[model samples]
Structure formats: structure tokens, C-alpha cells
Target: MTRTPASRRDDYPVFRRLQTRWMDNDQYGHMNNAVHYALFDTAVNGWLIEEGLLAETGAEAYFLVAETGCHYHSELAFPGWVDAGLRIAHLGTTSAVYHIGLFAEGSGTAAADGRFVHVHVVRGTHRPMPIPEAARQVLARLFPAA
Candidate 1:
């Protein structure tokens, strides 16, 4: 069973431009599936870290991955640059859903789309933590009221 991707360049709430490394491509001549998740993680975490929301000291204040999945729409190979888009689709008391779109540079639509859910938890205690107001502010921008 195949699912169509719902990602487009325009659907991305935030853009993170990335350069495809030569090593990203597998012998099959396309970027491996695992690489796409790496890109998605990079884009999302980079945004959070840059925004000072997910820091080493405060990382536990943020939850780790609870669920993740990606849908491939087209082949993207090495030497090609991509603009990774990020957005929040759902926000919960202790979890959040992020939608990531991978677009080939200059393309209007997405090459791949992914959804990741993370449940915030305490560092050592491993208990669910409430989503901070500061983090909510960022997520709100990506998930405005409909």
C-alpha cells in the first residue's frame, strides 16, 4: 500500500535549506529512506535548538520521539539541495506533532513528507511534562488557529 504525500513547498511553516551530501545517496542512486528521517530530524531539531527551546540542559524539558513516519513522493539524489519545511500540526499537554516537508530546491512541491510526534518528559524521572508556554509560542506560529 502506498500513500500520497501531502507536502508542498508552500505547506512548510518554516524552511531549513540543506545541501545533500554525496554520502546521502545509496548505491540505488537515490537518497536512502533513512536519510530522509535524518534530514527531517535535522530541520526540526535545528529549529528548536536555534530558538533556544531544546538545549542540552533543558532537553528533558522537551520530550523525545514517540512516533514518526514519512511518505516519499519522488526520488531525491545527492548533489541536489533541498529546503526542509517544518510546522506543528497538533499540540497536546505533553506531546506535539510536527509535519516536515522536503522540497527539491526551486521546486514548488515536496519530494517527501513526514510526521513526528514527541512526548515531553522529565530528564531522569521519565515523567511526562507539560508543554512550556515558550515552546507553545513557537508552535503556535506554525499551528495558528483555523
Candidate 2:
């Protein structure tokens, strides 16, 4: 199988700083693979929340994770900070793909890189729907040149 290269923090359009918790570490000492996925989820979802796109009372639709994958370039443990760099790879009428890079504090290279595709659907009906204009506006910031 071919290998994918890790992305640099500079390649991303936005970043979220997340703290590694004590429970994030595995018996092997480094963070468990599951935690990395959690970080990816936290980064993307947290950004949306911060941008005022997601709210408990006003939410109309929910973006469901349709697919995700990750590649690790280095190991990370607890008690340190991680920078989750984010960018948009694609945005369709009802779907969006986000690319993320997890960088250790003060490191230029990424410890892990990942991508996830989300499909927008009505909250109660679960039927596919077009992404809201507000969401598109915020997502466009991640692709300024597009």
C-alpha cells in the first residue's frame, strides 16, 4: 500500500489547541489511536460551535460523519498540548470534507493527519439537505482562494 505524508500546520487555515488528558494515554505510553480520532472530531466540531453555526436551541440540521481516516507520523502522550490544524478539502451541496493535522506543541510537523466527510441531514427527519448558507460562509474561510 502507498503511504500518505503528514501535513504541516502552515497548510491549514484554522487551528484549535486541545489538551491531552490523562485518560487519553494508553498502556504503551503514547496516546491511543482512538484518542487521535477524538481530537479530530473535537477540532472540526469545536470550530463550528465557536463560529456560531452550531447551537442547541437553534440547530436546524446536523452534519453526520460519513467517513473518516487517519495516518500517524509520530507519537504523542498526555500532559501536553496539541494543535489541531484544519482545512476544507471539498464542499458539496450536502456534504463537506475536512482535513486535519495534529501537531505537538512547538512542532512544525504533524503527529497525525486525518480527513472526515460529513453529510448534512435534517435533525428530526434524517433526510439529506443542502448545507446552510451560514455554514458555507464559515467553511469558505478555510479555502480563501477557492
**Which 10 consecutive residues of model 2 have the lowest summed lDDT?**
52-61
> Candidate 1 — which pairs collide?
63-120
- Candidate with top TM-score is 2
Model 1 lDDT per residue over 1-146, tens place: 76685666667667899999999999999999999999988888888878877758745565688888998888889999999988898899998899988998898888899998888888888689998888888777777335
Task: Report the number of the highest-lDDT candidate.
Answer: 2
Off by over 4 Å in 2: 55-58, 144-146
- CA lDDT for candidate 2: 0.89
- The per-prediction CA RMSD against the true structure, in angstroms, equals 1.8, 1.6
Off by over 4 Å in 1: 58-60, 144-146
Over 90-123, each residue of candidate 2 has an lDDT whose tens digit, in order, gives 9999989999999999999999999988898888
What is model 2's C-alpha RMSD? 1.6
Clash pairs for candidate 2: none
Question: Which run of 10 residues does model 1 get worst, by summed lDDT?
Answer: 54-63
